[model samples]
Target: MSKQFASAGDMAEKQTSFTEIGDGLWAFTAEGDPNSGVIIGDDSVMVVEAQATPRLARKVIDCVRGVTDKPITHLALTHYHAVRVLGASAYGAPQIIMSEPARAMVAERGKEDWESEFDRFPRLFQGHEEIPGLTWPTTTFKGRMSVYLGRRRVDIMQLGRAHTAGDAVIYVPDANAMFTGDIVEDRSACYCGDGHFHDWPATLERVRRFDLDAIAPGRGGALQGAEAVNRALDSTADFLRSTYRPAARVALRGGSLKEAWDAVRAECDPKFADYAIYEHCLPFNVARAYDEALDIDTPRIWTAARDKAMWDALQGG
Candidate 1:
């Protein structure tokens, strides 16, 4: 029984919601869909993640408009995923900020990723025509950069790699809120197809050192207060550790890819099967983890053909 390739079979549009999670901060979440964030400064605004298309991004803009009239000044790319940065033009932000590696990623395989993601998740890319093409960041930084919207200070920091080679998190110290990209998810599946599986936990620990009162995850709802924030962090760490560690061990012992896949499923499925995109993410996640376990430090570029081949193989086409 072969499984569908990635999210190709998932076409249901999720219900989007905007929630006020902190002072001058908002979380735009779709029911188990890719999440985005907004931070309002006294004089300007920053959008954390762009939606899949310009049309979808307009909805996020409306959400921002509902609360404040500040001009959107900066659009931050948490990483270089097409769904997270392609709709950036919709914000019309003067400065599009991203890590250097993220910028490099856009240059490396941006077009291929765009077509691949569009093919996998058509519902999210409903307004694909509206996209101006691969979004290139106007500003690129190496590590930490401070952004100020008047008196408000937002710290954009790259602790280490997790979901991608350049995962970044936005922190508002005064508000005690953090907008973590795909580095940490509340309930949504951790799509590790481009991740650094072995180092992900260490990176999460670096993020944990900060005193965060609330967190707007890359997916799922905003986690409010310290307790909820801590829980989400722990859950994300557990998901990474549980899935990758076992897969790595299997690969180290020269186990079959299917064996590693089954091991990951046996460990993660019982607890995470109900999470959003779990089924869609598992095979890819396991494959990447297996590669990492076998001494492959970098993830292979996922083209449309590669995605289908990997899914078909592990799912037994």
Candidate 2:
């Protein structure tokens, strides 16, 4: 049979874990699915990345309630992907935050993304019917902004573009911990469908300079301590380079997208074959890397039709 499209064939539910990486901060992670971060401040809480649907988000809510009852005052999204933002309603947080550019992407392609992602992985959208609509940020900033939950100061900053043109990282200074949405994944494949391949490494470097003690990454297990944090950072950078270099070589040589796909697989599979979502992410990552090699600065929007076309083409590669 033809390879399943995206993650459509992978229906096994991931085992979820809620880890306390800092004083009051938690990382709500699944085996390899998307992750949500929790920051329990003095008087309230700030949640990072809303998950794929209200039902999935409720799982996060249940985890939060197990620890504290602080009202979720702010919902911060790292980027505009449906898997990250469509579940906004569940939070009931008064203030929703995103970078200005991220908000713009939501306007430009939110609906299309919602459809494409839902089509790609039906399992993630457990309660698709409950998703009211595209998620929008109530509060937006250009580069940096700070939100204080009573006494704790959480710095939400857009360091540079990596996973998306408008990715943001949430840093809690008092704990020296950060919530890096898809910008840094712990042994999970970085989804590059809307990514900036050429700019990703530099952005990772900027995140590294922070010298974080712990990180609630976009996916996979939580990273605690300087050594573990640094390793994930380095591995993420390596994954990007391994994916882009071979694809770029093929594109520069006037090769086809399928050729680029094979090139990337040959280069990346040996190293990252065991990583979470590696197969699900390969085609999209190769496509973007091929485009970037040709100097395509902006990632093209992905629609359901385009997703199918790309997957079919790569399947025969």
Candidate 3:
């Protein structure tokens, strides 16, 4: 029944690749695992999207050490997701930066989310006990915040809500590189458990304005050049549209949840089946899309118990 739960039968370790997307920009991707972007400044370094735990974070730290000895001075969280923000303590980056909405999310559901995600994906949280609890931002800002990594301008700005209300991207103007959190996924399936489906496309439209030379997405390989970047962004948009459109059509016709779910499966399964996390995310994605189609603007909080219940019902367990 969809691997019983999230990542239940999948526990194989992935080969990590730390590729330099630009002169001073690095992207750490592990097959289809969550990616962490690196920006090497003239003086200190800045890390984007911390892994799930302190032990897992050490692997990223080692990769950074292989390139530069510069102490990381900033840890930028793209959102308030547990898997992305829990490992922040390992970086020891003095300043943790997040948008005001992100900080609010951390306050609203950080503890519940932490417990929920850990249960869902146990392998990613190899050192769960070491986590110092929910990661909090040292500094919060609204709209856009300009960060200078020795004149290499890293712009931390909120485009809109896609993956979460607090979703943000780290943009390096000179490098023509943008580090997008779950707002943009390449080959991996987008997890919409806490997403805003209605607003996701508009947020992606804002991402296009950057005229990117390279884009380090949330998962999968980094995109190089404008053409590849555009294609990746388009792919993300297509995913959102294909799911929401069909579901909305069903909901509008007063169809049942199963009808809505089956409609999405028939349309999206063939198109997205081979993508990473496709199986794990389908039910959740459909549920969110179903709600959004009914004009539910905000995403509902997913607890561990709720996750199992949803999966059981949708998977016909």
lDDT of 2 by residue, 1-317 (tens): 24666488888998999999999999999998999999999899999999999999999999999999989999999999999988889988559999999999999998999999998888998779998889989999988999999999999999999999999999999999999999999989999988998888999999999999999999999999999999999999999999999999999999999999888889898999999999888888999999999989999999998988888887665
Q: In candidate 1, which residue ranges exceed 4 Å CA deviation?
A: none
Candidate with top TM-score is: 2
How big is the positional error of residue 164 in model 1, measured in Å on the Cα after superposition? Answer: 0.7
Q: CA lDDT of each candidate?
A: 0.88, 0.92, 0.88
- The worst-scoring run of ten residues by lDDT in candidate 2 lies at 1-10
Relative to the true structure, candidate 1 has a C-alpha RMSD (angstroms) of: 1.3
Q: What is residue 235's positional error in candidate 1, in angstroms?
A: 0.8
lDDT of 1: 0.88
TM-score of every candidate: 0.97, 0.98, 0.97
Model 2 whole-model lDDT (C-alpha atoms):
0.92
Q: Write the per-residue lDDT of candidate 3 for residues 205-312, one digit (tens) a residue.
A: 899988889989999898999988998898899888888888889888888767778898888888888888887777788888888888888788888888877877
TM-score computed on alpha carbons, candidate 3: 0.97
TM-score head-to-head 2 vs 3, winner: 2
